[model samples]
Target: MRILLTGGGTGGHTIPIVAVVQELRRQRKDLKLFWLGDDHPEERAAKENNIPFQKIACGKFRRYFSFWNLIDFFKIPAGIFQSFFLILGFKPHVVFSKGGYVSLPVIIAAWLLRKKIIVHESDAVPGLANRIAARLASKVLLGFNAHSAETLSAKSLRGKYIFTGNPVRREILKGDPVKAREFFHLSKEKPAILVMGGSQGARFINDLISRSLSKLSEYQIIHSTGVNNVSVIARSDCRERQSNLISTENHYRFCSYLDVAKMALAYVACDLVISRAGANTLAEIAARGLPSILIPLPSAASDHQFANAKIFEKRGASIVVEQKDLTSRKLVSLITSLLKNPNQLETMSKKAKNTITKGKYFLIKKLRISIFKIN
Candidate 1:
């Protein structure tokens, strides 16, 4: 069996597709898989995973009219033509899309070729691509339960909308705490806090962390500062400054990225996580039962990250800090308070685990059967 997977422009879209591909490969070693993504980091991730990849040029239709909009408009036809030839030669039995601007043309091409289509929408409000693809796909999968069957068009409802909780990489599902600590040289005695800014890193969060590093030293810290901000952060000497303030011990570590296995370890070793509320991150955090301080990217499409964070906050699994209200003092206070209150942390962790456990496995198995048609 052959399958074509397409989605990109960010790790949020790419990572989940990679997760599904990982599962598909595990189940069917003979199956052939190809990834179609923009000439971006997502394609690099696919290559790192040893998946065959093809880069396509695509653009989004803007909500507002601009000169670039016309150029982007033209790219659509070019993208569709490019996708048509790729699909014609590849002849995938099915095309699975994690909706994004990059997936729009591939999905349209798949529809034209009468290829069986499966799409996963990872947001509370579906993206424009998935919203359109819903009309053409045989199945539309949702990551959340906010949208109802009746809300979809008749065609989409007939095709079936299944809530297949987001697919998380297998390594993340099971990380080794001891190994993670040893690999990162983390102290087992100190509370560990994992701070991240998604794939690109968040400048606001980075700045806050830089200011709060001294206070945060009471707890061991692992911060993924994102590639762009690494030099700035490293040169700023947040680690050195913290060591100076709190006895010269290795209580902090920073990196631009972490591979899946290392990331799994970080998750396993973490007592609390501070991160942007991306769907993929939320799934990973829940999978590991880590309590969180979620600061949603205010600019995320459809304000989806805020919604994602609220879902966890509602269950007392996380605390949501809007960007506008986020400050170094507030963050330090929250972390210090959460860490000191072990019972509160345990309660939040249990609740977080419960909320995610409610549907994760069933949804994963259901998606597997629906896409691969395996009983």
Candidate 2:
């Protein structure tokens, strides 16, 4: 009947929580929903979704030493206090934490208040935050298979784990190719490739794509360059350069960010996707049965992006191109080769779709059972 959701830091942590919120609302319109997190993209997402949101002070835990670590040490207690007061007042029936530093304080508070807590991890390896949250959580849901989390096996968490393939936004799977083609003013003449750099966008991928525009002339392009990098790539000089390099028959569309509507359309319109291998992004791509070339961020926490990409590659869902080894020429060649073979693309798409868990409705059922048992 009532739910408290928390997660932040990156879209990967926040987006899945949003998907869960959406599903919960669809199933029960009268449900009272509240979000607790830091002042980040999740705040904006909560506002857009009309979920009542309250901010809590949170701190990051870094592996290496930093001057900020000294300051962050104090913030942890402050965050716990903030969470305690907030959770005590809200007193929700259940708290679902999509793992992030922000979720730790919230989960600890929920446990202290004797509320049910469910935590989800989106990586092959659990982060420090999730590992801590798991101790207090009644259930630990995983994006990958349970065996992939070798680090978790040695922990004291005995009965709190289940493998739930990453939750994807249902809206993503509802795009119409005809509507998408018209919406983007794209011709059906050439195969379209969608390039996504996550919510904040990846500078490395953006730069490589900019330089490789000429090489992608055979395909129509739909590029989401993140909100921050859109203007930089949209400047007159950049546009002029892209125009000269791109063939007249090919189309290039650039967007700073894609909302739910545009995102679904882009997914449907594109024949292939080139993206950073964030778990949330891969989940959406897999749900749509799209073949992709994934460029893992070398700097991702715990090198999780590389791990995620490798799994997809092993499953025949995607091609992994490490950022360290990636070049404009290399990316161009891979794209062209993949696109040239329709059968391979189709096979990859089928595998990608198969990777997603069948019967998503079961998650909703499981959540309801958990919540009712708690109530």
lDDT of each: 0.81, 0.81
Q: Write the per-residue lDDT of candidate 2 for residues 22-132, one digit (tens) a residue.
A: 777776777998999998888988998999999988889887999998898788888889989988888788898988888888888888888888888888767789888
The TM-score values for the models, in the order shown, are 0.91, 0.92
List of clashing residue pairs for candidate 2:
none
How many backbone clashes does every candidate have?
0, 0
Candidate 2 scores a C-alpha RMSD against the true structure in Å of 3.4
lDDT for model 2, please. Answer: 0.81
lDDT for each residue of candidate 1 in 72-120, tens digit (9 for 90 to 100): 8888888899999999999999999998899999999999999999988
TM-score of candidate 1 versus the correct structure, residues matched by position: 0.91
| Root-mean-square deviation of every model | 3.7, 3.4
